[model samples]
Target: MVAQLETPILSSPCRVPYTVEGLLQVFTGSHRSFFTNVMAQALRIAGQGTPVLVVQFLKGGIGQGHEHPVRLGQNLDWIRCDLPRCIDTPQLDEAETKSLRDLWDYTKEVVKAGSYDLVVLDELSLAIKFGVISETEVLELLEQRPRHLDIILTGPEMPKAILDEADQITQIRRSHRP
Candidate 1:
């Protein structure tokens, strides 16, 4: 099931100041289930003129597998890393790896510039483990991120380094059992 935020997260008194420093939130577990839950949370935090960038790291592309681009308020920008959107093979080819690198570079630049109040690296942890990007590179970028920018990383098997730095770590278990 998709997890839903109880209410507008930013409007709460306990909300962290978006510009004070960078924060990392990691969400892990069932892909479809947790992705739904994380997006719900992002939507809640995106109000009040906060800019949000969503980088979809993995998605289906062909026949019966198209994913709707995620968007909330006008401040939200969504980019899908897998285009034509097919699933990756067990191993990525040279071209695929380069594409992933380019995406990572773009994400890094966006975070470094502090362009968005919130940046969601959807399925990024899985991408890192798949060798699409390096965990070291991600950690370095996180280290340099603008103090005020809040980031959300989602995907199963989150790396220990990311977990160490995350302000919140949520594991969304699947509700349905086979």
Candidate 2:
């Protein structure tokens, strides 16, 4: 049976995450290889004992959704959508649309719970651009996120609003191999 998602309620103040200042960081580029660096960084952070959540907004085919998180070293939680293929365009069937929405809702719930010190939203911009996810809801999530939860958003065509709130923005460009 499919697990029903309950309405998210944010009232806990349990974790203070080992951080003084939680900053919004953005990494965007034309190359998908940039994700490798981010993953390495997430692993490093998790190794340091910080809880990290890495959500791949548009990636799937592994049959893993919010309920089945791949835990790496007890600190990092990696999750993706439950769709059969990666989302490339806006068009989606009813089932695919519901799956994507479930992931988003689950992500928001975990973020609200302060379950992770660092959260990575991978390929999120593409979801937003494709109209699978609303940019306004993302903004609301940012505004309501825990004070010490550092978030790193990775994808191309990031919205200006998100860029404006970013404490640091890294834009990658393709270049010939050295």
Query: Least lDDT summed over 10 consecutive residues: which range in candidate 2?
Result: 1-10
TM-score of each: 0.76, 0.87
Residue by residue across 1-178, what tens digits does model 2's lDDT show? 0111234455767634343667788999876668998898899888877889999988989999999999999799999999899888788899888999999999999999999889999998998998888999999999999977889999998999999999989999987897
lDDT accuracy of residue 36 in candidate 2: 90
For residues 1-178, what per-residue lDDT tens digits would candidate 1 score against the true structure? 1121233359778875432445688888755457776677667666555678888776535322113345557778777754455444547777556656766788888889988878889888878878888899989988998877788898878898889988988888767678
For candidate 1, the clash count comes to 4
Alpha-carbon runs more than 4 Å astray in model 1: 1-18, 30-32, 60-72, 175-178
lDDT of 2 at 164: 95
After aligning candidate 2 to the native by TM-score, how far in Å is the CA of 170 from where it should be? 0.6
Q: Model 2, stretches more than 4 Å misplaced? A: 1-19, 176-178
Worst 10 residues of 1 by lDDT: 60-69
